[model samples]
Each structure stands twice: as C-alpha cells, then as structure tokens.
Target: MSQHLPRWVLPGAVITVLLLSWSLAVHFGHAPLMPSPWQVVVALGQLAADGRLVRFTVASLFRVSWGLLMAVVIAIPFGLWLGWSHRAERALGPALQLLRPISSLAWTPLAILWFGVGDLSAVFIIFMACFGPLVVTALNGVRKVPSVHLQAGRNFGLSTAQLLRRVVVPSVVPQLLTGLRQTLGVAWMVVVMAEMMAVNSGLGFLILDARNAGNRYDLVVAGMVLIGLVGLGLDGLLRRVERLPGLSWGFPTARPSAAPAVARLRLLRNP
Candidate 1:
C-alpha cells in the first residue's frame, strides 16, 4: 500500500491508521466517557434513521449561509471604499482593529441578552465572527490592485462607478475569493459554538443535548464527526469554485506549450 501510490494516498492511510488506533485504545481502556469509533458510527446511523441529524445539519447550514452572505455583501463594499479613501481607513481602522481581537465566544453574553437565545442570536454571532477578517481581507485586496490599471481606467474618462466596476472589481476578484474562503471557514467554526449557546436546533445543540439527556458520549462524538465532515465537504466545494476558469485568474497554472524566456534564449544561443 505504501509503495507506488500517489502522494494523497499517504494522508488517507494515516487517517485510517489513526482511527484504528483510536478505536482500539477506547475499546481496551474501557473508558465509559469516550465512545469508540464504531459506537459513534452506530449513533450517527441512528440519528440519520430518526432524521434528527439532517434537521440539525440543515439548521446550522442555514445560519452559516445567511451569515456569510450578509458578511460578504456588507464587508466587500465597505472595505473597497475604505481601501480607496485614506481618510475613511484612518477613521475606521482603529475601531476595527480593536474589535477584531475579541473572540466570538466573548460575545455570547451580549448575544443572549440582545437576541435572547434564538436563530437570530446564533446568526448574529456567526456574522460577527466572519465580518472583521473579511473586511480586512477585502481592503487588502483592493489596495493590492495595480496603480497602472487605475490610471488606465481614468485615462478612458471613466466615472468613479465605472472605474470601480471595470477596473477595481475585476482586479480584486481573486483576493475577494480567497477572503471569502477564509471567512466561510471561520464562520463554520464559530457557528457550532454559537448554536450551542444561543440556539436549540443545530449540530452544536445536538452535542450539548446528547450530554445533558443521557450522557450519550457516542451521540456527542457522532455530532462532532458530522460537523467535521460537513465542513470539509463545504471547503472542497469552494476550492472547486476557486479553480473555475473565470474565477481563477490570479492563480498559477501550468502552460505546457510555453517555455521560459531564459530557456528559449539559451536554446537559440546553443542552436
């Protein structure tokens, strides 16, 4: 199995070994608190059979989707504006910097007080978790756009809106996509915590409920595994989008037919 396989095979093999070791350890240790992998698998199957897993997963996904959409819509424009205007960045940068260091869990008390333990509270928490980094990323992306492109757009007698639409937005798309991917990852990470504290119907709540109802460690582990797998799937989907032809403008790809100028020069000299 180790001999002639591709590089990706090693990671899967490592994960399998780790899982087998974990299952063996739990089985032999007889630790009632930790459920074996097989127990978690059985519990997950039971959850699916009862449809609770699907319901809870969908609830969490809904919150994350809405939260990320809101973050992207608001953050990108504000960041673009901020990047364009030195005055605006100076005015808001300090405040944002102050707030960015605050952890999402730190807002749990205020989230509960303001929204009172519901979907809104959970969504709000997820939104805040994603917003700050996204803004910063977008601003950086806009700032990184080349001055030549801006000058070229202006030379065409473009209006401010036209310049943004034709020049800035297209140039920033790659960076924005990168930011979006990072923001969504953080959003997913925070949603579970937010749901646990602020909502009654998500994968996070399922884990908490499992513990409280009957100390069901198997169910808790099952919920954790589902969250991990779903997050991985979502990220994989986003990676595919990032590699799409139109969206992947700034990414490096092989140009099989083209040789480097230095290589061409050397070949001509030798020939």
Candidate 2:
C-alpha cells in the first residue's frame, strides 16, 4: 500500500520542509539578502499583475525551444553517421571531446561579438550547451545496439537503410529520450545565464533587473522560483513521454512474479 502511493509525495514533502526552513531563516536571521518565501510569492503576484512575468517567461521558453530544436536536427543524423562509421567517429570524436569540456558561459563573449547581445546570442549559447551531450548520447545509443538485431534484420533481406530505420532507430529511441531530458536541463541553465548577461528579455534579466532597480531581493527570489518551477515542469513532461507505451521499452516496469523467479534462480545457483 505504501509502495502504491503517488511518486511525488516524497518530493513534495522535501520541498515543503525546505520552504519552511527558508522562511524561518529569513525571519530569525533578518537577512536582507534572503527573502521569505511569502515575500517572493507576493512579488511574483505583483509581477503577474503587471504582466512582466509572463512576458519574460515566454521569451525564455521561446529561445530554449528554438535552440533545442536546432540542436536535435543537426545532432541526430551526424551522431548516427559517426556511430555507424568507425572512421568518422575516430576523426571527429577527438574534437568533440575537447570542446565538450568548455562551459557554455565561456562562449558569451564570442556570442555577443557574433550575434550582438540579443535573442540570437542567448539561443546560440543554449544550442552549444545542448549539442554536445546530445551527440555523445546518440552515438552511444547507436553503438550499443545489439549486433544480433542487425544480423536478424540482414537475414530478412533488409537493406542497410531499412535496417537502420526499423531496428537501429527503435533501439536508440529510449537512450535518446534519456539524453534529451539531461540536455534540456543544461539548455535551461544556459538560457538563464545567457539572458542575464547577453539578452535584455528573460527570467534571468528579470532577476538582474529587480536587483539593480531597487534591490528588490523578493523579486529576485521570485524570478529564481519561476525558473525552478518551469524547469521542473519541463522535466516532468519528458518523464511522461518516457512512460508512454512506445517508449516504455527504454524504462524498467514492475514485475513482482519475475522478481520471485529471479530470486529462486539465484538461490538454486548458490545451493
């Protein structure tokens, strides 16, 4: 019965505890830097009343969506090709490895120089942040596809393209989904940073603007809360995708009977 409880219960409890602790700290410590959660909530309400919160959130979401779309389009095919051909992976993998370690924030100066402190600059930073992890994950998924599956496809007289489309792609979908979830988190973080420094309109800008305008720590905290909530919602949506029937092959499903059988087999082997 306990196991059947909603998955979110634990997380909700944790968040509640954290928020209570934050409120207490703000009240007791009288720290001007940290606003009580209620103050942030009120600030968010005021922003909503003025319509700035919606505008900033939408702007940030638009940049992230466009950047992620572009990264997915370019990375998938290139990763597949690299995984299929040893020569390509060998030739290109080193460069990717070297570049992957460089933080997306490091690209801000160059992005500003090239795109000139606007939506394009922020989008470019998000693209760079998402691209590397995506390519690496896609390549790994392709390379790890079972050779037996490929052989079976060949035995059925499928051409290389047919085998790839039918077998290789299906096998890679689960891992790709996992990679996308992770890459999206990185992209979200990058967009906020980019917006703070390179762009004039976004949640990040809201945080900075609030601070600079009147030292409104409450509004700054409000912006931070909004970013976290939005990121959580985006991740939750992707998690739902992973549970879809077609994508469930990538995730483990509960099987009580199979677990007992596995335990029995293990006991028999040990005996």
Candidate 3:
C-alpha cells in the first residue's frame, strides 16, 4: 500500500513555488520599490546586527504579557460567576455582549486618552482584546462540567471552595488553556495596532517608520515576517501545553469556542 505525503510537504512546495514566482515577477515588473524575499532576509540581518530586533520584540512581548495578565485576573472570576449562576449571566450578559462587538482598534483612541501615549496605553489595548474571549471560554467550560463529578464531590461532603478547587478548576483547565492560546494570538496582533500611534519602539512602529523614511519596503517586510514567526512560535508553545497528560481528557467534549462569535463581532465593527 502507498502512504500519503506528509502534511508539511505540500505547504513547503507551495511556499517554494510562490517565492520563485515572486522573484521572477519583481525582476520583470521592474518594481524596484518592492523587496524580494532575499532582500527581506538581508534587511532582517541588519536589524538583528543593530540589536533593534531583540529590543523591539521584547518591548512588544512585555506589553502583551502585562495586558494578558490583567485580563486573566479579572475575566476568569467573572466568567466563573457567570457560568455557575444563571442570575449573574442574565444580569451582566447584555452589557458584556454589547461591548464584545467593539474591536480593540476602536478603543485605541480612548486607550490613548485614558492611559496616554506609552506602554500603558498599548497594554490597555491588548487587555481589551483579550478579556472577552477568556470570559467566554471560562463560562462555557464551567457550564460543561459533568454533573456526576459535581454530585460526587458534594456527596463526599466537599465544601464549596473545596469542590471548586478539586472539581471545577481541573474540569475547566483544558478549555481555559485553549482559550488562552487563541487569546494570546489576538493579543499579539493587537499589540501591533496599539504600538502604531502611541509608541516609539515596537515591530509595528518599525514597519511604519521604515515606510515613511525613504520608503524602505525591505524593513517593512522584515518586520511583518518577524511578527508572523513570533506568533507561530507562541502557538507552538501552547500546542505543547495542550498535549500534556490529562489535558486531553477534557477534549472528549470540547466547549463551543467564542472565536466564531468574536469573528462576527469583528464583522459588525468593521461594517
């Protein structure tokens, strides 16, 4: 029997073909302003040699960590309450749903006003981007907790706090991690937008500055490549966490993720 080709093969071939085509097109089209893949690589080397690459990447990461941390501290508890109590959900659902439709970019103006033109403003923007998905993830996960597990805990004479610790938290961990993975990606993307106007040093600012200063498209492309690679690295790390023992037990019945609803919100905001 013949085996199928590996998943990486197709994608690698497509990328190789695209690069060849791009180089040919640029050479023929006489688009001197456009940077070929090799030119982009050279530009990336220049940035790395100057230490700008590490410095800018770290600055962006610092903002994302702070913002995501703030969101987790607040959203998880609120989401738990909303899931465990029908009344709480009914009460706060409308307000949160109203806010969910607003894109993080929409809040950039207010974020700048509230936090000023600094790292704090960028961090705040990332927080706004992360909060809603995490809440939804927690709420959905809590709702999916097996009633038998809850009953078994209660029958063992576990108190509310004990039951929450032993039962609810473990049950929710898998979904929460997945949500975090998605949220982290959103936070990374949001940081670029957050950096564009209110910050002097970040990959986003690097791209913008490159464009304005002598129209250095090579640097712009290099910055974009770095953003995508870093995002992929983050996702790979999260995937490792997902594969840890016991996390998969919760996936037999995964929660309906908030991503689709969030996509709809983006549509509404953009339209």
Top lDDT: which candidate number? Answer: 3
Q: State model 3's lDDT.
A: 0.86
Candidate 1 per-residue lDDT, tens place, 1-271, comes to 6688888888889999989999889878868699988888899999999999899999999999998989888988988999888899999999989999999788889988998989889888888888898889879877876665566556556678877776677668888888888888899889998888889999999999999998999999999999999999999898998999877764112332223322332442345
TM-score, predicted candidate 2 vs. hidden true structure: 0.89
If both were scored by TM-score, which would come out higher, candidate 2 or candidate 3? 2
For each candidate, the alpha-carbon lDDT, in order, equals 0.83, 0.86, 0.86
Which ranking of candidates, highest TM-score first? 2, 1, 3
- What is candidate 2's lDDT per residue for 140-174, written digit by digit as tens? 88888766556656656668887777767777899
Enumerate clash totals for all models, in the order shown. 0, 0, 0
- Give, for candidate 3, the lowest lDDT window spanning 10 residues: 260-269
Stretches of model 1 off by over 4 angstroms after superposition: 1-8, 251-271
For every model shown, what is its TM-score relative to the native structure? Answer: 0.88, 0.89, 0.87
Can you rank all candidates by lDDT, best first?
A: 3, 2, 1
Q: Distance (Å) between predicted and true CA of 230, model 1?
A: 0.5
